[model samples]
Target: MKTIIIDDDATARLLIKKMCNAYSEIEIVSEFSNAVDAIKFLNKNDIEVIFLDIHMPLLSGFDFIKTLKKATKIILTSSDENYALEAFEYSKVVDYLVKPISKKRFEKSIHKLKSVIIKDSLVRDDSIFKEKQRNELYVSIERRLVRVPFSEINFVEAKGDYVKLKTDDESYIIHSTLKKIEAKLPSDNFLKIHRSFVINLSKIIDIKDNSVLLQKEIIPISKSRQIELITRLNIL
Candidate 1:
């Protein structure tokens, strides 16, 4: 899980980080000494879990929970055990670790998280497998059907009579409509951002104003499709 540690005490954060590093499942993306800074990071990032302290200055953990735009899993790391019952009232608060935290206690909390993730992982893994199976397609070139994988493709553009498949290795001009090509491509990664263009969302390097940068090329995003594109993005 992609996680971040938030605690007022630097020592407690360090201890939690160290213990988290021992597990392969936890990937600590960042650490914050306060919830305010952590909230800023969370706004632009997709975080799976958070290690938060309850009695921090300025914002209490309960107060911080209300600021969230989306429900995010939080594990309380507190010195006090009095608020355990109250903390469990929040649906997103998974496990509470009373400080000073023991390795065994932390392991138990992680086990709880793992159980939930493992159940969800099965469905995600199957979807990934299905996505992988359709990674490539066959295109008619000079009367011969050539196989092309989606991984190598950057984007697809429509010419008057043909659709141009722009890939890393070469561009193939196929006598097909953009709509037909778009239908063949995977919907998760490929998006039709304009009337004449369909882009690979994963290949995008940056987005500025009304344009998306893909390696060396900048594709214009139609005002009509701009919101759909943004909604599809894993915008952090």
Candidate 2:
């Protein structure tokens, strides 16, 4: 992800940059000693993440985040641990990394960023999926909650600890286990295709080789579930 460092101390900025060198995914696009110049750069360019200092010379970190109308993820860096709760009120702030930040702690923060991206992706997918349905399930996106019809749901895919709900319009990720959501769904219409996915039987437009086609997307049907899917179709 693209990121920028905003801190008054050059030494602190250098240290933070050095720590970021450990990861290939994170790139420091620029660094600013004050929030004023940083704000100008941010206005013109889009940044996925920010390493913001809690205390600065003129404009504090809290005030800097407030200036931007659009939301972007932030990780607050500070010597003091007191403002952690206050920082959370700003939806953009994902974590509070206490200084001097350890490599392990920094790595942990990177992991968190990955999960956030996955969760956000899931939410986006879910929103699109819901938009095309007649009977839908709703979830939060940005600040608003939207609905998606159950019939339009194509399937759900599991990635690590998260689940991706795929529909006709898009797919969504929720930080939930598949088993938990499986219980909530109607088993009569949906069937587990693989260990990682659950497909809507009625939504299958075609079954080719080892995969099932829904609309334009092709989803794999596991060897174990192939017979069950065929049987569920009630072939004479």
Candidate 3:
């Protein structure tokens, strides 16, 4: 991944660069002493990741992030840990590291960056596929064929002979089987976590033990399906 360092402290920048060198995947493309210079460089260059210092001379890291038109993954480095919560408000901020960053913590941040990249790539690829295939499902409701966009679907629960399609806006109960609906949904976004439940993997909030949290719902994951779900995640 192409990376850049932005820190007012020269020693801090050097240390981060040296640490990043340990990872063969990261290539240091540029270094800036202030947010202003970094912003100038970023206007013309495309970088995958940035090692940003929250406290800077002219513009602060948070201010610099607000000025960006494109979303770039940022790992915040700071002497004070107080800004950690605020830094994460921006979705672009991947990880926050305190000054005197340890090797283990830096490695964990790299893992997070890779996971974000993988998830983003999958989302983009799925979008392209949706465009080509016209991702709309035709469901028999009443006597008419209702059109439902694949992206709106949250999960499908088998209710005897009918399947309940829960979405962000509303729910629909159609005369179908879980297996049939699962076949239509994209494998990348949807997974069969239980015999009667097929969840939209993208909608997941957290996974703990045998339960997966989706919105306000806690859905159980069968023992056999748990392994498959974990395999799908980009874990380091």
**Each prediction's number of clashing residue pairs:** 2, 13, 0
lDDT of 3: 0.91
In the range 74-148, model 1's lDDT, one tens digit per residue, is 899889999999999988888999999999999999998877667667988999988776888889999998889
lDDT measured at residue 45 in model 1 versus the true structure, 0 to 100: 97
Rank all candidate structures by their TM-score, best first, as comma-separated numbers: 3, 2, 1
Distance from true location, Cα of 215 in model 1, Å: 45
Decide which is better by TM-score, 1 or 2. 2
TM-score of each: 0.51, 0.56, 0.58
Candidate 3 residue 92 C-alpha distance from true site, Å: 0.2
Q: How close is candidate 3 to the true structure, as a TM-score?
A: 0.58
Off by over 4 Å in 2: 134-236
lDDT of 1: 0.91
Model 1 residue 189 CA deviation (Å) reads 30
lDDT of each: 0.91, 0.87, 0.91
Model 2, residue 56: displacement in angstroms? Answer: 0.4
